[model samples]
Each structure stands twice: as structure tokens, then as C-alpha cells.
Target: MRAYLALLEELERRRRGNSLAVYKPYDRQAEFHAAGATNRERLFMAGNQLGKTRAGGAEWAMHLTGRYPDWWVGKVFDQPVRLWAAGVTGEGTRDNPQRVLVGPPQQQGEWGTGMIPADAIADTVMGRGAPGALDSVVVRWGGGGDVQAGESVLSFKSYEKGREKWQGETLHGVWFDEEPPLDIYSEGLTRTNATDGITIVTFTPLLGMSDVVLRFLSAEAIQGLGSSPPQGGVAA
Candidate 1:
């Protein structure tokens, strides 16, 4: 009897823990960029802690788990997606992008507490690099009563692995949590070309006028820049 009560309490806690309110964009800019983005390639470039990474991570969670909120107006996939989330190095990728997508690297028990709801997490494959980091995660689609629902895969990648490592696989989406080199970025672009897949980048423009930054800037300029960084806008 005691065990049964404990189980019920645990389940209740998880139910309340997965509320969408925990992950909503903090401002209009974040809301617009995360849900309003229509471009095939989108860049959320801003200064530190302005919710750039948070917006990107939230959108990616929606895409991967197929659990979009009612307010979502961004790109939607009819089927399960295969995505790559990348960063500057193995440790950085694990600590930042991977952490945002699936929770803390060192805390396996806390895996489902990030942007991904606890119930949507299907399984995780452990990676060899960076202690307790994940190589990939499988997200269970709620199906929403549609026939296309299933498990979506999120793979962890590193820019330090080079352009060659980015080659070959055809992906549904790619999220770069940091500005990647031109060659690596180009390789990522190629992987998504066949599927008309989307590429989302979230970064601080600390590199100033680098090639990757210039690509987004040349087409459309970032707006409303202030001391604290643009909250959550996207430039494509």
C-alpha cells in the first residue's frame, strides 16, 4: 500500500512538472522568432543570456517530439524527424546544446526536465565523450491522432569534428548552438537540401563580422539591438 501511494505521488509530480509554462519564451521577440520563423534557414543571433539558446532549444524540442503548443506557428513536420544539434567542441556540444535538449550532462536522472517534456522522452543512447553526455535521444511523438507519429531522433554533433563528420546523412533539421565555420556550415546545409529541411542557428555574435554571421546579415539585418541583446528574434 505504501509503494502504491508513492508511485501515485511520483506520477503526479511528473504530470505537474511537464507544464508548457516552464518553457514559454520570456518576451515577444522570443515568441515571434521561435514560433513565427518561416525561413528555411533561421538564425537567432544575440548577446549572452537573452534567450537565444532557449528559443532554439524550445523550437527544436517541438520539432523533435512533435509536441508543438497551440501558439506555435513555425515549421511543422508530418513525420518523425532526424535532427543534429551541434556546438563548438565535444564538451561544449554536450554541455550546451545537448544539455538544453535533454537536461544536464552529469544528471541522468534529471534527463526529462529540459525543454523536452518528461513523458516525451523515449530512450537515450550514451556517448563516449564527455562524462555522462548523450550521443542521441529518441523522442516519442504523441501522434496527435495523426498517422505520422513515431519516435524522432536527436543526435549530438561537434564543429570540432570538422566538415567531413557533418557529411553524408540526410537530416530533417540541424540546430547549431554556436557559430560554425563556413565549411562545416556548408556541409550541414548540404545534408538538409534533399529533404527541404530547416537549419536553426542560435549564437552570440562575439565573432563580429565573421563569414557565418555575414551570411545572415547580408540577407537581412538583425533588429532592435540593445545592451542586453535582442530577446528572441530571428534573422534569415
Candidate 2:
């Protein structure tokens, strides 16, 4: 059928690295639903093991690398862009979304084969394995100073800090992982108004009545929610 043929073509395009990772219908819908509106805030709610973290990680990776593919606007980041990639805490960044960003070994089915490899990324964002490369691929930035890597330097922070040190700074992008508190998200967003970049918060909605839950459930926000069989044989 024509639909299946189109799907195959798109898959081939992705294989050739000509497109961003393909989202499921619901995920794709959520992206469009959030992008179309002008709301300063948007949220995606779903059960665990869903692609919420994937969506955010993918977008953040692309934007930081200045590699905005189709269906994404406002992602052309300025060089050495100030970025803060955070989770529940520093260790959490070493987990979910950050793990994806850094290219840990494939986890069977959770990420499928679509996840980007750490090596495949340009030297600007990740790093090239030179003769004297560091032990790990981790790059550091921040604390009233900055790192001048070819790619944007993203400092990892914890949601527990609230608005304390996160305020009174300018940023080009901010990514919050796994249900960061609403106040932290708000404060992070304040730092991300450089030119016209974006602030991304990605998480599966666990608690039913949180402010984030309300934000996405509100009539105007994109609504993507449901349950699916676990991927990678893991509950996520």
C-alpha cells in the first residue's frame, strides 16, 4: 500500500541520517500539538517506559548540536550556547535522558536502534577520541564561568536546588528530566530566553495531580496519554 511504502521511505531516510528519530503517532502528535501553540509551557504525560524522555532527549541533542531537522523550528542554537541539562539530581542525569545523550550500549528494545550513538555525533557536541582523550566523555561547564567547547557546554544541575543558583543567568536551552518540580522548571525557563531558543521538560506523568499534570491536561496543551506494552523488556 502507498502508506506502507511511504513509511519505508521515511525509515530509509532516517537510516541515512536525514531526519530526526521517528516518533510513534501519539508522540508525533504531541510534538505538533505543543509546537503549534504559543504557550510558554507544555507537558507530555504518560505511563512509564513511554517515549517522553526520548522525545526530550532527541530534541535537546538536536538543538544543542544545531542540527534541527524537519518539523522542528526555533532550534538553531548559537555557538557555545549556555545549556543546563538536569534531572531529579545529578545522578539522574547519569541515568535516563543523559544516558541516551551519552550513548550507552543499546538496551534491546526500549530505544530500538534509533538512538544516536555517542560517536556518531559531530565533534562539536560530543568529542573526538584523540590520543589523550579523557577517561569519560563527560564535558563540564558553568559556575559564573563557561567552557568553550565547539558544541554547546551543558551543565548538569539538580531540581532540588530550586530557584537559587539557576536564576540571574542567561541560557540558550534547558532540559529537565523526569518530573522536575514546577518551581524549578519555571526558574530554568527564565534562564533560557536568549534570542529565540527553547526550554524542554520531558517526563512520564506518574503522580496524577501535579502541576505538570494539570498543565498538559488543560484544554489547550497537547494531550498524549495511554499505556503500551513495555519496551526493552524493561518497565522504565
lDDT of each: 0.78, 0.52
Off by over 4 Å in 2: 1-39, 71-80, 105-150, 216-236
RMSD of each: 3.8, 10.6
- Cα displacement (angstroms), candidate 2, residue 91, comes to 2.1
TM-score of 2: 0.59
Tens digit of per-residue lDDT, candidate 2, span 117-201: 3323433232222222111222221222353445455556667656795788787767777777778877887786654545666
List clashing residue pairs in candidate 2: 110-232
Q: Candidate 1, residues 1-47: lDDT per residue as tens digits? A: 99999999997778644644366665644644554356788787677
Clash counts for all predictions: 0, 1
Worst 10 residues of 1 by lDDT: 223-232
CA shift of 214, model 1, Å: 1.1
